[model samples]
Target: MLATMPAAPSDINVLILDDNQFDRVRIRRMFESLEFGFHLSEVENLDGLDQNLDNKDFDIVLIDYNLPQGDGLEALERIQKHERNCNATTVMIAGDDQSQIAVRALKSGCQDYIAKGTLSTHRLRSLVLSVIDAAQASPTNTDDLHERLELLVSRVKEHHSSALQPKVAMIIQDIRSLRARVYQPHSPLAVELAAVEKRCLNLWSSLSETDAITLKAPKDVRVS
Candidate 1:
């Protein structure tokens, strides 16, 4: 009997960074043939990668180990630093037989490494699925905090829209007062805001840790 296969989920966005046209074409074809879903975009080099990243959000990044200016490792480091909530698992692809490079990539936060010559459609599908699973399993607290802040801002805007003339005048006055107070270096309100921001970040970190632990427990139980 044929082995059962898992159902394909909705298409996840993927960014492929490779300078070689042949490799990019081949990788795209392989992904197209897979049962796994993917909305793919290709970049020829680091510049292209940067532009694509600025405009789009990808679920996974497949970076070539060798590039024109700098290698994949450098690109990975830059991406991690610049992209907020960049939890996308990076996979380093190489044609060379350099085990050390693979190890280094893994150390630098790559989810997996695949030799270019050995890449197959099935293996690619499996790797993508694993990365997506890991991302879903690990939720970042910074993202949650940013989301809450956005919601608060939206509510404030809504209140501003529905306010009467007197309320609007009062709100405008309050804003001007707050701005003036913030300009003073020794202002108590500024100190208070700083403390609140720090506390919120700490709370976010604590919540992230707690959520990670909660997620891992169930996985551990299933594995055991």
Candidate 2:
């Protein structure tokens, strides 16, 4: 039983994959109270999840541990294959306290996790801001940044699409080294990136709010 949530004003795009109607409703209600404008799309099973990820990239992806049709961890593992969606910040939501699942998710690359019972409007909002901040923050080292840049360049060259924005396919096709851009203030993708960031900041003024054994952050990034 797969379904897509109706569209909303999109300050950020989020894709949520979970099978339970009640839990999905709860998650949606949390977003409704937030000031930020977000477009959310939900899918109940693995096929739906893969179909959505294949066509569009989400800024954040939240995955529930139990699914009617498949394991959330297994789905997370497969998401790595999506070159663009692979970089989306991911978080895991579990129905119960499961340290092993949490650890495994972290090791696999998820940025954060929380028990479903513990979720609250305030907590959800805080986590959203923090993770988005972390995603925008520059890498801790040059090599890490360089590696990302090279990866982006190569991926875009092969696919003729940007991992950052599906719409801005060739945005960074001719990107200069990030090392130079660090001192320069703007890169080729500056305009688009700035717009995305400015929206995040504005959403903060308004207020608001996945996984991947499949997608991992760089080694130096330690989520608090």
**Best TM-score goes to which candidate?**
1
- The best candidate by lDDT is 1
Cα-based lDDT at residue 163, candidate 1: 33
User: What total of clashing residue pairs does each candidate reach?
Assistant: 0, 3
Report the alpha-carbon TM-score of model 2 versus the true structure: 0.56
Candidate 2 lDDT by residue in tens digits, 13-120: 788889888888888888767766678899999999889998887878889989887787887887777887987777889867676888889898887887887887
Whole-model lDDT values for every prediction: 0.70, 0.67
- Report the number of backbone clashes for model 2: 3
- The Cα error of candidate 1 at residue 185, in Å, is 45
